[model samples]
Target: MASIGPNEIFFLLQGLKWTVALTLIGFIGGGVFGLLVALARTADHKLARRITAGYIAVFQGTPLLMQLFVVYYGVALIGLDIDAWLAVAIAFTLHASAFLGEIWRGGIQAVPKGQTEAAKALGLHYPSIMKDVILPQAFKIALPATIGFLVQLIKGTSLAAIVGFVELSRAGQIVSNQTFRPLTVFALVGLIYFLICWPLSLWGARQEARLQTASR
Candidate 1:
């Protein structure tokens, strides 16, 4: 068996770029789509609300691994020839959107009902009301949860390996197989993940504290 060496470590570190890329794609796509979902959930129309709720249910209820499988293989079965990276990106985006939508929905609802009423009393349109008043407050409430979800999303990218994306976890698996050092390889993988996630968790906590203090 080959020994784990500098080259092996560098190879694994290279996977970090894909991990970071996937996280960015997931968060950016999910955040935009999720904002729409949150708005629909909060809309006056019952049909819109129900549709967004169902979307959230299906994505959030299922395992992300299954979602990735469906996106990767199911698309291939349809003859689209989607890239594995694209497939992983799409699946993670949908997965992250559902959870984010729910998080932001709660944040929207948590805003004082009177604020909405007051906006309407000022004869503001729905968009204006939301844009100028409700969403700002909701964003503050949502920031911590959004950050938390993003951190989880980053960790969850490890699941992309299941669909053949050789990210950090997959790199570890490969290194372990070659070096016959499963424990050491995976411990290093865990440490890398910790290094990425710990700072985000701390930032989220600090933001949450600041929001609470501002609220009070």
Candidate 2:
């Protein structure tokens, strides 16, 4: 068995970089689409609500690994050559969108009905009410849940390895194979993941606590 060295460590760090990149891509892309989904879910029209609800259900109901497989391989069957990076990005974005949309929808609903009524009473249009009044409060309410989801998204990036994406988990696998050190390699991998996620989890908890205190 080969000894673990700086080279293995560096390679793992490289994988960590891609993992962070994928997480960011997923979170940012998801956040944009998710906001729209949240709005649609809470819309006045039944059609819009139904459509977005269906969108959320399909994504949330399915496994993310399946989603990645469909995006990575399904496109190839149709003669579209997609890169693993792009495919994983798309899958994660869609996955994150469904989850974050639901989180934000709850936030939007949590705002007092009086707030929307007051805005409407002031001759505000739907867009104006949401943009100026409802969204700000909803954003604050959703921040903790959003961060918690972000931690999940970070760990979920490991699934990209299934699609041949070279991420942190994949890197650990490669190193473990080369060095014949599965335990050491995976221990480091777990440590890195913990380092990345634990703080966010703590922060989310703290925010939740603060929100509760504020509400009380």
Top candidate (TM-score): 2
Model 2 spans > 4 angstroms off? none
Question: Quick one: RMSD of model 2?
Answer: 0.9
What's each prediction's TM-score? 0.94, 0.98
Score candidate 1 by TM-score against the native. 0.94
Can you write out model 1's per-residue Cα lDDT over 85-157, one digit (the tens) per residue? 9999999889988999999999999999999999999999999998999999998999999999999998999
Q: List the residue pairs that clash in candidate 2.
A: none
Put down candidate 2 lDDT per residue, 142-200, tens digits, no spaces.
Answer: 99999999999999999999989999999999999999999999999999999999999
Candidate 2 Cα deviation (angstroms), residue 108: 0.4
Question: lDDT of each structure?
Answer: 0.93, 0.96
Q: Find the 10 residues in a row with the least total lDDT in model 1.
A: 75-84
